[model samples]
Target: MFTQAKLIITAVVLAALIGLGTWWHLSRVHAAEKAVHAHYAVVLSEIREKTAAAVTAFRATETAWRSAIDKEAANGQARIDLARHDAAGARTERDRLLADVARYRTAARTAQHSSAPTAGPTTGDALDLFADLFSRADARAGELAEFADAAHAAGLTCERSFDALSRTKPATVQAPQSNQ
Candidate 1:
């Protein structure tokens, strides 16, 4: 004979496992996310360094071009072109990185704050956490899509700019003829 008490007990046990599994999965996801964030931080630092170098190089070339032209006649269109290309590429990369950071921040926040809905067990003491977990997972999925788009666009733009910059000639100014 099926008894109400037995059925209730069975339901509670099932709910407990569901809650535990949800917690475990979410914990694993959080760990993986932390690793991803660490890797991204390193990459972001590298990107910043590369962008700064590109900017410095561009500025130096600009200064040289200005001084050369001001002192004597010099055409440094190639250098100017290259500098423009570098700046544009850096801007694209920085923008993409910012986008990725925004997505990650949103995901982390959602994970930390969101909670799953629950069915009140007969004991009414333990709450269901799986609902919130599901919500967080959905949020992460959305964030991942945005991150992927930014990465793809940034990669394509960087590749194109690098190709263009590589083909450009280093601008040179011949010393003005001196009738000494």
Candidate 2:
């Protein structure tokens, strides 16, 4: 009979097994996460480098444009001043747009930190420790999985054997044979 005590114990064991399974897989999951973060970091760095280069090129172009506009032999000082003021406005707009793009890119990442290390602890000590722990736990889970399978098969076999042995068979009768 599956008494309450037996039921409770089974529940506990099943829960423990699930917990172990989760821990075992956590190693792989964590590793995958670290890989993704590393990839993103590399990408972000590349983006920053490229952005800086682009900004440098933009400044150079603007400088050249300003030089050309200033050196223009226009007879009207008023027109020259107006053109310079417009160029300044364009510069302001460009700078504002660049700042907005950077801000939005940062915002896209959301909370910025969790389940990952921030610019700290370049040492591999803690990493090695967790790697070892996860490896051992996962290996243990593999062993337990084999045992769990065998136990399941054994339990089913035991139940079927008992059912066959304890079940009552119906009695059968044959008609009396006539003399031949």
Candidate 3:
């Protein structure tokens, strides 16, 4: 009876120890799983945040790029408009100069045909009038040349600006951060 009693007591204690060890091991496993889940959550949250930031930065860059394009387009258009205006003015001046040249030629031809016979007051007056007409024609020609030069310069400047604008490249988008 005493041996039987000792065996039963030992068996009960062994069962209790087994149950306690299993509970402890299960609790440890549960804690490990919880920690893993928490780490994954943190990593996922970081990834999401980085993605959001990258998207925002990309949008801002796009907006800036668009604005720059718009401004450049406007500037280019303005340059073209100015060049056109200058060209028109040059044309008008050239036409006026041509008309003046025709008038001067006609006047010279008429004067040559109607020269005075003797050196009298009429002859001196005719000479003075011819001199004044020649001077005025020379001044008009100079003005026409200046207008041509200015128009050419303006056209070249506008073309250069257009070429520069075409050559310009937009800024590249930055790569997003690694989620590792």
Give the alpha-carbon lDDT of every model: 0.58, 0.58, 0.69
Q: Model 3 compared with the native: what TM-score?
A: 0.57
Q: How accurate is candidate 3 locally (lDDT)?
A: 0.69
Per-residue lDDT of candidate 2, residues 113-149 (tens digit): 3346568763354544655565566556555654555
Residue 128, model 2: lDDT of 47
Distance from true location, Cα of 172 in model 2, Å: 97
Give all TM-scores, in the order shown.
Answer: 0.35, 0.32, 0.57
Candidate 3 lDDT tens digits, 8-73: 999999999999999999999999999989888887887787778777776776676566566666
Q: Which stretches of candidate 3 lie over 4 Å from their true place?
A: 1-12, 113-180
Point out the higher-scoring one by lDDT: 2 or 3.
3
Is candidate 1 or 3 superior in TM-score? 3
Q: TM-score winner between 1 and 2, please give it.
A: 1
Off by over 4 Å in 2: 1-19, 74-180
Question: Can you write out model 1's per-residue Cα lDDT over 1-180, one digit (the tens) per residue?
Answer: 378888999999999999999999999999999998987787777677767777777776667655544432212334444545655575566567556655765665565457554464322121124334544565565556555555555565555455545554444433333223
In model 3, state the lDDT of residue 172.
53
Arranged by TM-score, best first: 3, 1, 2
